[model samples]
Target: MRIALFVTCLNDALFPQAGIATVTVLERLGHTVAFPAAQSCCGQMHANTGYAAPARQLERLTEDAFAGQDAIVSPSGSCVAHLRAHTALPVYELSELLVDVLGVTDVGATFPHRVTYHPTCHGLRMLRLGDRPTALLRAVRGLDLVDLPEPEQCCGFGGTFALKNAAVSGAMLADKCASAASTGAEYLAAADNSCLAHIGGGLARHPGAPKPIHYAEILAATGGIRE
Candidate 1:
């Protein structure tokens, strides 16, 4: 399969590892992963904040960036949700592509740490991808999937939410991080960097947080060990 990765701005800047892990896992699975140079933001921030005109302009640009591909895959479910709903192109969440579309599971990887998943607002409310990521995680060789206390809750980073409503966002993140910590999980992973970073900041503020991981990092565990 020829797959194109839409590395959103957040992943490119703050969480490049998720982008790397995404490429690593896809190539390891025998698919050609192309990082489109033209790809950029899907205008989610603008749309979420009620800035219609710029959001639509940016969305059109995003469509042009991902114009042709067997399938466009994104590590962030929020972005993928945008493509899935607002754009005409076929889009897939990384986990949904691996577990549902491609029919490839058990990624031949091992992650021996207990981990919980944080479903971001866009992924859960926008995409409604229930149990799909969890199912894929469970199929990994040595993964121990734990039930997040409130798996469906948002971590409160709605793109600009953390910056705009720091106090409210921080409080919500505290609750999410506390839930992840209570699970005794080594990692609190999610598909969205915006949320993961918000939760991670809360962890950094607190004494001992499990620290959030991008789901792709766990999926790409073996170093691709390189060919």
Candidate 2:
């Protein structure tokens, strides 16, 4: 399958490795991944921040960027959920594409680490991606998948929400960081880097907190950590 990767703005700029790891995992599964150079932000930030006009424009731009493709996949569940709601494009979150569309779970990945997954708000509530990510994680050879207390709670990284409601966001993030740290996992994995960034920022202030990593990186691993 020729899949067009919509490396969202955040991943394209700050977390390029997540996009690369996504491509690595897909290619390792015998599928070709194409990155549409014209692809840019999915306007999730704009829309969520009450900038309707700009959000619509970015949505149109995204529609044009991936005009024609067998399928479109993005590493960020938040971005995918926004596009799915605004456009008719056939976009799927990585887990949705892998477990639902591609009909595979393992993806031949091997990551030996104690890890816990935090279901992002978009992936958990909007896309309803239940057990798909964990199913894939469980298949990884030598991976110890631990349970996160209150896994469904939002990590307080609702894009602009974190900035606008800094106090509330920080409070929520504190609870989330505590929950993730209590898992006794070396890594805290999530489908969306936006949340990981927020949770990771909060976790960094403490010692011995599990490192935040995108699940795609975990899936892309081959008995060794990528980067």
User: Runs in model 2 with CA error above 4 Å?
Assistant: none
Query: What are the per-residue Cα lDDT tens digits for candidate 2 across 86-120?
Result: 99899999999999899999888888899999999
Position 220, candidate 1: lDDT? 87
Candidate 1's residue-wise lDDT over 9-97, tens digit each?
A: 88998888888888888888888888879877888778888998998988898888877787888899988887677789778888888
Candidate 2 TM-score, true structure as reference: 0.97
Regions more than 4 Å wrong, model 1: 223-227
The models' CA-based lDDT, in order, is 0.81, 0.91
